[model samples]
Target chain A: MSVLLTPDQTAFLQGTLSMNVGAVGRDGWPCVCRAQGLVVARDRRSLTVLLSASRGRAVLESLDAGSAITLVASRPATHATLQLKAARAARVGVSAAHHAASARCVAAFGAELETLGYAAGLSATLAGVLPTDDLVALRFAPDIVFDQTPGPDAGRVLAHT
Target chain B: MNISLESLRPCLDGAIPAVVATASPDGTPNVAYASQVHYVDSEHVALSFQFFSKTRENVLAHPYAQVQVIEPKSFRHFRLKVHYLRTETSGPLFEYMKAQLAGIAARSGMAKVFALRGADVYRVLDIENVDPRLLPAPAPPDALLKLRRTFAHLGACDDLTRLADRALAALAHGFGIRHALLALLDETGGALYTLASLGYSASGVGAEVALGEGLIGVAAREAIPVRINYHTGDYTYHAALYVADPASPRIPLPVLADPHSQIAVPLTHGEYLVGVLYAESEENAFFSHADEDALVVYGRHLAALIVQLAALPDDAEPALAAPAPAPSGAPLAVRYFAHDHSVFVDNDYLIKGVAGSILWTLLNEHAASGRRDFCNRELRRDPRLPLPDFGDNLETRLILLARRLAERCPQIALEKTGRGRFRLELARPLQLNAG
Candidate 1:
């Protein structure tokens, strides 16, 4: 059974917030970096996130290992978080339409950071700017979704609706 | 420049979640976030193993790991190369981490979840300062220097009062702590009474909190330190956590509105619990890991002073002296709320509990024998007032009663004439009513 993203989860993914991805490669060294160029597929069956070519080397290697990984998208204002446990990942080219969404995502996430008590310019700084070259999108099918909000429901496995 | 793991402690306190990376035996690398990287020693740190299956598997199988931690106050980051050690399910470190996790969990509304499976202790192999900004270091409350200075000044205190004042002054100057309170453990073995407090509207001079009650109680009960940082969370919910928690004390313990940070350190000498040192602030994350470390060291100095002073002989003359004649006035009515032992003088609220009973008892004795002077020994032995088992808060109760009387009920007052002895100065005759 494939779990579809709930309306709330869909809203979270589309909202302005920095996304982080975690993975362990075949060699077993774990790595994580700020993920940009986030896109939730229209059907909510999968997610596509882009890692910069220049800064996401370890992250790309982890994805290349094809090991299970976690994608966490969180709003800084309320610490509300959602974790996606993805089983498979593949690299894809960035589309022009999706490229514009990436800029909008950073701007929105920056607004959330400001609401969370960050200084005026910190949001822009904390949001990792997408690199121009080798900006690869990771298309992964989420096996399970976990509510990663900073509370009891955090990490709770959500049923596929 | 290289750094010892301990020097990077402030960064590891878990305020800012740390990211950990580990490689499998086959050289496959993994990365995940950790809630806290607890400092075990200069050579080790304990990472919480809750449910990160991959990270756990990698560490157990490979032994090599790296964690990147950021200092919350100053956003400096440090990377620690560590090797996996044994996992501890139970012990001092585990329990301490459990308490800390509880605070963090409770603050984040995850107290019901985030179970502590084990404390995975890791031996630090190397530490690297990720950024070597050549800037003047931020002042850290000068913990080491202030601790040394506090110890020297504490050594000069000849009495408990002086010792307490010096302790508060030391924390203020050394730790940059703005608000602090020192409460001596009552003889009842179950309550702590306010003796000295700074940074409150009222000194909360005579306020009392039972053992195992609130933050103060938890620290005293476990003989451990409890610290928390919250942007917004009502501490009042603590009572709901405990079924039989007494209704919020009428005289509320001094605390800031929306207290962003709080800490309570238990003071003990050998097996005897001396008192508790509590500090709070309106600023978020006001106290850091280094502050906790500094205070724990200075707490030893306080424990020694408290024990030494308690063992020292009383220097004041015995009480039983007839007080100056009572000035004439309308008979003021003293009402005692037996339910909570709250006392009100002529409808004006005064002290309560053992403190209230003590005042009522003193006035009772005055009406009967015309004697105004009383001593700690007499109050401790008084049968009319119910002091809890081993309740040695007499001297402090007298201090509370005297201060309350002096503040609210000016007509009838109690003043300390010497150590353990005080004279009741009655400006108006009083009628005691038992409620």
Candidate 2:
């Protein structure tokens, strides 16, 4: 059965969490890249993950309709982690709204990194959040959510609302 | 341009957590932060599998993975396409990773949560620099040249004591190793005793480490080199395992209260455990894989020299010494315990075990006849002393006893008159007591 993200989980994923998006290739091997931000829909059933076009070109090219996708979001300081798996995902066209939302999220992440001993501009530098930066968005409705908080209880399935 | 994983070893230090991406057999992808990405070789790498997470399950189903590692200093990212090879639960690699995880876990305040279950080996199929921008990496020191020079200096030593001194000196000067120790293995007792040490406030000579106690002991027991780049309280041998017994005076093992990096290399000759060479630094990640490799080679040279020097027969005749005049000052009380053969001078601990027995025998003969000269052959044949077999390390025990006396109580000193011969020089008159 498909599962939807809980209110708390959706809010946490949209916050300053470090995100990594992965996609499987035709050869069954997987490719991954660091994502800048995640924007969850009002229904909390679908989300848009953003990545730098230049750094994530290989993963972007592999993303198609019905392509298997996984996005892991983790809080660096606490190592509180969660994995969202979508059996079908696709690359979506980028819009100015998506870019602006990603920019604000990246700024928040940079502030979060600052508290964790990273430099001020580190998040922007890592995410390539400049005005000239090219961003790609992959949208998927996760069907499974797993708690990956790094302990014996990790990999346990999270209940959906 | 082609890039080798060997050149990017600094990225594997766990300074920046690496991300591993794998897929399930049904084409579902899994991505997570890898606890550790250890460099096994140019073609192989190992990741710490602490828990059976989705990543582990996916990798078991689909063996291919993409690992993204970043050099912390430059923040340059490199992607490695790897294939799962196998997993090792126990062995040299497992122990190495386990020690590494302990340190990492302690640093992150997750010491109990993070335990290494196995070392999952992976074959790196390809490597890619995510960004084309490059930073100039500094050239590493020539370890081969340093090892060659150290071996050259070791080849010139004449005796076991001199050989130990020269090797420690070489480790300091040639390899820039500030703190180092060389210990000789006591096979019958299943322990290793410190023969020589440098860069410690105390020489810690005559100190003992059981065959399976700490880093040095573990290396000796496994006959492999073990290294850790961070301080780990898990292997606190002296503080946790050592118990002081009044029956036997314990020689405290010399240790840095908080060592950030340490490496112990076992000195072995085929199947025989010869000794262990150990060094530590206050800086994290100070010892590299190249340093470990050089030390392993250097340990071999040390083992061969020890065997060679021990087997050489004494070619010089025993020296004849005149009886010394008794001192006029107050006598110093020398007490001997026959239980563990511990010897104390002026009610202070000096040494114990075989060395202690040798000292008691020498002092007894001196009190009875004022004899100052001795030879290795006589000590081995003496029924009163419990000396090991002829091929065993009688010379090393004398060296340990000689060093302990030189450090603790300089009133009595042993000087080598020639090979296999030595003279006991006493500056004070002593009253011998056996309790």
Candidate 3:
């Protein structure tokens, strides 16, 4: 069954909170890590997560074989969570726009963590090491969208119209 | 070079999240993001088994797995090669993981959904530091130094009173903790009664918290350390809420309105649940992994010390000191509520439960017979004080009563005259109101 992302969720994906990508290997094992950047496609039908080359090796290798990808985006201040699963996945070179979006996301994420009571200088310090020089954008069209907001309806799907 | 699990503690503490990857026998892999990987010991770690759909199946088929962990401050990553061990359905570890998960779920607003079915224990086959160490991070000067000082202070105490004093002092002076408490288990009441505290306007001594009710109670029940980094509404145990709740209608125990960070560690002596040690701070994530680590070490020492002190025989009292004449003043009105065993002095709430009952009995004896000297042996034999478990807590109760009377009802005080004997000192005339 296909699902769609709500408008609010689309904005959330494009927001500055923390983002993570989980992908299964060819042998059905999973690899996940913090993403350097995330951008919800303008169409709101797909997402572009800039995977860090140094840390996301397994995720990058699992891009083929149509290995499933689950993107968990969360707001640090509110603990608001959204998990997106996609079977149709591919990795492409990071575009100029992807870099801009990724930059915006990291900047906002650090701010969010700060606002949520983490000490100052933490966000900036984290951002310095997170920005990857070379990146690959793992873009996937969403086949399943779950509420995952840490409650009863967390895993409930957003059914497609 | 092979690294032991002890060296990887900074990674296993779970301040940061972890990722688990498992491959199927058919060469297909699955990945699941986990909130934390519980470090059971040096060679073992347990993962929460909560409605495991894919990871379970994949792990069953392919037992070998890899976990990636990140250091919060350093951004350093470590990988662990682990082999799946048997799942624990029940035991101290399961209960510990279950309680910890409840707190995590509550903070994340998933309290009801994130239930623990079993704890999946894994044997660490190897630990690899993926990211090269950058200027090896030194242990915080305060944590290491403070833990040593705290342990030393606790080790030197020969009695429970001095032990408690040094423990609280270490928390405040050595560890720089503003708020902390030590409550011992009341097996008879199935509760933990507060005996000592620091950084509260009121010591809240003698306050009763039922087992499995609040953070401290749950920690004692599970016999595990419950650490909450960020405060949430779900776990906040308000005094007023408990008064209305049927489970614990005795008295509402006091805790900080909204403690940003709280950690409660259970004190155990062998198989017995001795008590719980709780500390909180207004600052978010106030307690670091180091703080928890230090406190854990201190708690173990404190528990052993407590057991040793408990095993000692009662002390001999000094010759009874002559009771001084009452000061010239108005009679102090001591109102006793039989319904809840709450005592009020001059209409001010003093204490309730066993402590309250103990106070009323003390005052009654002083008013009738003019007897000021009391001993632990007699209080244990008192028929009206609702003694439980063969007076196992007589001296502690006296200590609690003495402390409460000292803090709240200054008109009346109980000064220790001997090892297990105390002389009731009245500053003014006493008018006892019994319900």
User: What are the RMSDs of all candidates, in order?
Assistant: 5.6, 3.4, 4.7
Q: Over the stretch B1-435, how does candidate 2's per-residue lDDT look in tens digits?
A: 289998788788766678999987778788988878999988999999999887899888888999999875455678999999999999888877887777666555567788899999999999988767555335568789888877766668879989878889888777888888887787464788889998988888888877767777778777888877666666542222432342356877777877877888989877777999999888777777778889999998889889999988875676777667766577889999998889999989999888999999999998899788999888889988876665468898899999999999898999888899998888888999999
Candidate 1 has a TM-score of 0.74
- Model 2 chain B worst lDDT window (10 residues): B237-246
Q: What order do you get sorting by lDDT, best first? A: 2, 3, 1
Better of 1 and 3 by DockQ: 3
Clashes of each: 21, 0, 13
Better of 1 and 2 by lDDT: 2
Sort the predicted structures by TM-score, highest score first: 2, 3, 1
lDDT, candidate 1, B1-435, per-residue tens = 267766777676556667777655655444556766898887889998777566788887888777877664344556677888899997557656765665555555556656678999998877765435423236666567767766665568766656656778777766667888887777567777777788878776666667766667777777887776543343432311321225734555665655667778888788788878988877766777777877877776688777776456554657556637647868888888887677887787787777888887888888899887777777777787777545365655666666667667778777766666678888887888988
| Candidate 3 lDDT tens digits, B191-271 | 788878888876777777767766786677778787766555564332213322254334344568878678888887777
Model 3, first chain, TM-score of: 0.90
TM per candidate: 0.74, 0.89, 0.80
Best by DockQ: 2
Better of 1 and 3 by TM-score: 3
State the fnat of candidate 2 relative to the true structure: 0.77
Per-candidate interface C-alpha RMSD? 4.9, 2.1, 3.7
Candidate 2 Cα misplacement greater than 4 A, ranges: A1-11, A96-132, B136-142, B145-155, B235-248, B320-323
Q: Which whole-number lDDT from 0 to 100 does residue A110 have in model 3?
A: 73
- Higher-DockQ candidate of 2 and 3: 2
